[model samples]
Target: MQTISSCVEAIVLEQPFLEEALSKGIINYSALADVLQDDVSQTLGKPVKAGAIMMALRRYKDRLTVSKPYYGLNALLEQLGDITLRSNLSDFTFRNSNTLIDSQAAILNTIKNKSHIFYTFTRGILESNIIISSSEKEAVLESFKNENCIALKENLSAISLVLPKHNTKVAGLYYQILKRLAWQNVSLYEVISTTNEFTIVVEDTFVDSAFSIIKNLNKN
Candidate 1:
């Protein structure tokens, strides 16, 4: 754990831009000290002493605040701001060949298989991967099996619960959860959101642990 002062110095060192803000008295030094301690303590998983906090304050006194308080914006943004929510909780499901429906129908149906395609709809038109304009469900179904078109198979080993937006509050929530996973040495392959959902593909082995973590998060 960082002392109150060490945390301040760390913040200043991490974000050099904050120095100018401090000189102009835009930030209250005491408040800045308190916020850093509170935030970092949670991250470091231990109580931060005030003396170390004061040391950090003096160390970065010259470059304390440039525009605003510099806590851990980079760390939080790196983890949280990238998430996109394409589909809601209802949109995710597993599919199997026995019950594979047209891409459009699959949007509402949950099938179980290793391979599946996810489709997004806009104004009754399938704008994303389902590309062709179909007059009816049968036509839409035919488009998927069309020999002229190249079909991409999506494989899901593990599911990622994407948040709708990447606001400060939501970012904080993900950062905390992701940090725990990182500590356990989990690797994540993330797909950035062009649509609504932020997707993270993890190995099948970690699904149970990941789900447990999420379930615990929900309880809190």
Candidate 2:
């Protein structure tokens, strides 16, 4: 039989948003008990009352709050540069092939002069997904026209946030930035992560909103 304490722990662990709310003391215990009573009983294969669940929640409240404070997070945010927006972007995906391997140098040389370029080479067991992004659509098309391209997507835009180098060991920094964007219903076409910076590519229409959403991460 699963104890109430163990079940509460499992619930908090599985639900990140709920864990955050509980840690921040913003979660209504009565509502949480009401919501989880059925699930807990089903999991335990018995009838568990809401009052018992609430008591268990209170007993494990401290254990449920497990958020770690990232030191120097504010200092790193202060060093963030202004958001840079680029338009008229294009994304190209090429199938994995020997020809694709030989064509990489030519394609890179073609877009080397563009204002901005994002290149990702993802290899799978059977194939690969090669993504190349640049502002020069015509040049990109011209370079890859003869290659074995499995897909091509265009009319994309990029919003890059240049952050200062923070401790990589610190947790939840990326989560904080991504969670804010998610809450605003911003869809990311792609994300390029680095040691000190993170860039997200979105459609031209959402560029303004995405930038605003990311910039607000520093406020809290």
Candidate 3:
């Protein structure tokens, strides 16, 4: 049995994500505590220790992004299979020898045989694919289609932005913006952030709401 205080300390110190949550600015610690308890209990399939519960809350505190709410037409459309969601993926292709080589000998053999055979390593850029998204939004939603929508070829359409390093301020601003937009039933394909600005990809129909949310936040 871990003391609640110790649990909190352990969580705060162990997880980098806790800080990420705090930067978003809208998290309530008490509410987050409940969510953490549920998560840990679910993961363990039994009641978690008091310390673990405390740790969960502390862990959540430092997170930069939180889940968004979905409702309205977009929600209905999703249930009806009318919308498509693009997911962020990590894909890689590597070329190596067909022969079985063991440990150091393999590395030495590969290096030695480097000139005799062609070994190619290929990787995909950290970019989102648009082909996975549905075209229904584009046909019926005029506002979504015309708004500076850049095509990444195939079927993917995106609006990209750059942000500075993964710091509190930068994470907080974007997290707040995306959360609100998502609540308005805007389904973002991806929200990718680097050391700087963040980029979000949404279905065409949700673009109007997304724009409105951003504009409203700016005014505030």
- Backbone clashes for every candidate come to 24, 0, 18
lDDT of 1 by residue, 1-220 (tens): 4455555566675653455455455766666667677766776678876556655665565543443342444433344323222221111222233333444464334322323333333321222333211212344444344222323223223344544454343324445566556657766633323333444444455656655564444332
Off by over 4 Å in 2: 64-67, 70-82, 115-135, 146-148
Number of the predicted model whose TM-score against the real structure is largest:
2
Candidate 1 regions with alpha-carbon error over 4 angstroms = 1-8, 11-116, 119-156, 162-171, 194-196
Could you tell me how far off, in angstroms, the CA of residue 149 lies in candidate 2 after the best superposition? 3.2
Ranking by lDDT: 2, 1, 3
TM-score of every model? 0.33, 0.82, 0.33
Report, for every candidate in turn, its global Cα lDDT versus the true structure.
Answer: 0.45, 0.72, 0.42
Across residues 1-220, which tens digit of lDDT does each residue of candidate 2 receive? Answer: 6798799779877877777777678878899999999889988889999999888887666664443454466566666776777666666666666666656667678767764576655565555454555445566567556766666666777777777655375667777777778778888887877777677888777888898888777787
Point out the worst 10-residue segment of candidate 1 by lDDT. Answer: 84-93
Candidate 2 overall lDDT versus native: 0.72
Q: What are the runs in model 3 whose C-alpha is more than 4 Å off?
A: 5-171, 191-198
Q: Report the C-alpha displacement of residue 156, candidate 1, in angstroms.
A: 4.7
